[model samples]
Target chain A: EAGVAQSPRYKIIEKRQSVAFWCNPISGHATLYWYQQILGQGPKLLIQFQNNGVVDDSQLPKDRFSAERLKGVDSTLKIQPAKLEDSAVYLCASSLASSGRGLMSEQFFGPGTRLTVL
Target chain B: AQSVTQPDIHITVSEGASLELRCNYSYGATPYLFWYVQSPGQGLQLLLKYFSGDTLVQGIKGFEAEFKRSQSSFNLRKPSVHWSDAAEYFCAISSASKIIFGSGTRLSIRP
Candidate 1:
């Protein structure tokens, strides 16, 4: 089966410019997530979507970052007026729906988009 | 708040040597634990997971992790190191419909 797919494996933008990243999750997957991974650090959760509806986005910086999954299949994350601190890899992941036992399924990740803000 | 901690930032061992990476978590209840490996320019891949049942979970690529409740730790181990095993390893905990990841451990194998 095909895994999660992302676009523009690498990106470069100037500070204060806007950037966007795209993600297409695995087929039939019901949950999608966006994460930001700074150098030498683990990926941090930016937002989570369950079938086009947001499940969690508490950690997201609303002032500069936003994400949406319109059809519950693909997602997009945007950052406006980006800062140097925003330079990091943006990762997308997807997982199957929760089971009757309420167990979280394994997450499949994409190659990620490395955004370099100069 | 729930969190995962990887105490080691980087570790190096000779090829064919044993390897271990430490992980600790903070949560109120039992959590689902996982170990993922990320190679350079690649996405994270699940190595193993522990939800219930056996505390010692075996994963792909000959990786294994032991979940210790008393210590609140889930440590990954490999019997022998391989050059291909060089990668960033992350420990994660899932609970209350949320998942948290550790800072990650970088593994390097010496020839």
Candidate 2:
């Protein structure tokens, strides 16, 4: 089976510039997520989507970051007026939707897009 | 607010030695725990997860994690360490349809 796919494994942009990262989840997976991993830190959940609807995005910085999933398959995360602090790896993961009783399927991750804001 | 913690920032172990990484979580109910490994410039990989049933769950790559509800901890253990095991390990918990990760523990193998 193919794994989650992401584009531009690496990216570089100047501060205040806009950048976008894309993700294509595993086929048939119903849940998708976007995370940000800073150097020497664990990946932080940025947003989560169950199908075409958002499940949670409370941690996301609404002023600068936005994300969307279309057709419940592909997702895009965008950051505008990027700052140096935004330099980090953006990871995408997907899993089968909740089976019931609050059980979650294992999540498969992509190689991730490393965004370097200079 | 649910959270996961890896008390150790980094650990070094000789090749062929036993290895253990610590993880602790804070949640109200029976927590869903997971351990993931991330190599340099790579995304996270699931090592193992604990939801219910057996307290000790074995995972791929000869890794295992034991969930101790009383202590609120899910620690990863490997009987023998390999050079290839060097990487960042994260412990996570799923709550309210979201997963939260710890800061991560970096493992270095000594030849």
Candidate 3:
């Protein structure tokens, strides 16, 4: 089975420019997530989707960031008017939906897209 | 709010030496814990997880972690380390259908 896949392993953009990252999760996985990992820091949850609908995005910077999972398959995250603080690696992860064994299912991650906003 | 904490930013250990990385979490209910390792330029890989019953969990690459409810800690350990083990390690907690990660610990190996 293929693991989660991400595009443009690395990206560079100027401040105030817009950037987008793509993610194709493992087949049959019902849950997808986007996270941002600043240098020397852990990945922070940006958004999470269950099927085609968002389950949580409370931590996401709504004013600048947005994400969507179309058709409940692939997902995309976009940042407009990016700032220097937005420079970080964006990681995509996927897991199976809760199967009554608790909500702690194992998540598979992608290589991540490193976005450098200059 | 739920959160994870990794006290060590970086750790250096000689090859073949024992290794231990610390993790702590804050949550009111029973916690679902996980340890993941990320190689440079690679994605995060699950090392192990603790949900219930067992306090000590063994994982791939000879890694093991013990959950201490009293201390609210889950520390990863390896009896004998290898150079290939050098990577970034993260501790995470699952709460309310979301997972929160610690800042991470960078492991370095010395010959």
Candidate 4:
């Protein structure tokens, strides 16, 4: 099976600028996620979508960050007024089920978009 | 709330030697645990996961993790180290839906 696909493998933008990342999950996947990973740190969940419905976005910086999964297939994440702290790799992953124990269902990740805020 | 902890930030071992990486988690209910390996300039790949039954689970790349509920630990082990094994390993814990990961442990293989 094909893995998740992401575009713009790398992006460099000035602080306070806007940046957008796109992701296409595996076919027939019902769950999608956007995570931010800084150097030497674990990936942090920013938003989660379950079939076009948001399951969680508590950690998302609503003031500057937003994400949407339309029709439950493709998703886009936007970061407005990017800050130095936002300079990290944005990874997109998709899974078959919401239950973590969905062992048969692994979250396939994309190459990720490395954003540098200078 | 569930959280994962990797005590070792970095570890170095010679090639052909045994390896072990520590991971501890805290969750109120039965936790779903996972191990993922991330290479530089690459995405995180699932190595293995444990949900129920067998405490010792085998994953890809000759890696295995044993879940110890009494100690709240799920440590990864590899019998023989390979140069390609050098990468960052993360331990994740989840309950219900949302999952949380640890800071990650960097493994270095020396020739």
Off by over 4 Å in 4: A100-104
Give one digit per residue, the lDDT tens place, for model 1 in B6-71: 999999999999999999999888889999999999999999999899899999999999999999
What tens digits encode model 1's per-residue C-alpha lDDT throughout A45-84?
Answer: 8998989999889999999999999988999999998999
- Model 1 preserves the real interface contacts to a fraction of 0.58
Tell me the number of clashing residue pairs for each predicted model.
0, 0, 0, 0
lDDT of each: 0.92, 0.92, 0.93, 0.92
In terms of lDDT, the poorest run of 10 residues in model 2 chain A is A97-106
Question: Which 10 successive residues of model 3 chain A have the least lDDT summed?
Answer: A97-106
Give the Cα error of residue B13 in candidate 3, in Å. 0.2
Error of 2 at A106 (Å): 1.0
Better of 1 and 3 by lDDT: 3
Specify the CAPRI tier of model 4: medium
Predicted candidate 4 versus true structure: per-residue lDDT over A15-45, tens digit per residue = 9999999999999999999999998899998
When summed lDDT is taken over every stretch of 10 residues in candidate 3 chain B, the lowest stretch is B92-101
- Which numbered prediction scores highest in lDDT against the true structure? 3
Spell out the clash pairs found in candidate 4. Answer: none
On residues B1-111, what C-alpha lDDT tens digit does candidate 4 reach at each position? 678999999999999999999999999988889999999888999999998999999999999999999999999999999999999999998755666889999999999
Find the number of clashing residue pairs for candidate 4. Answer: 0
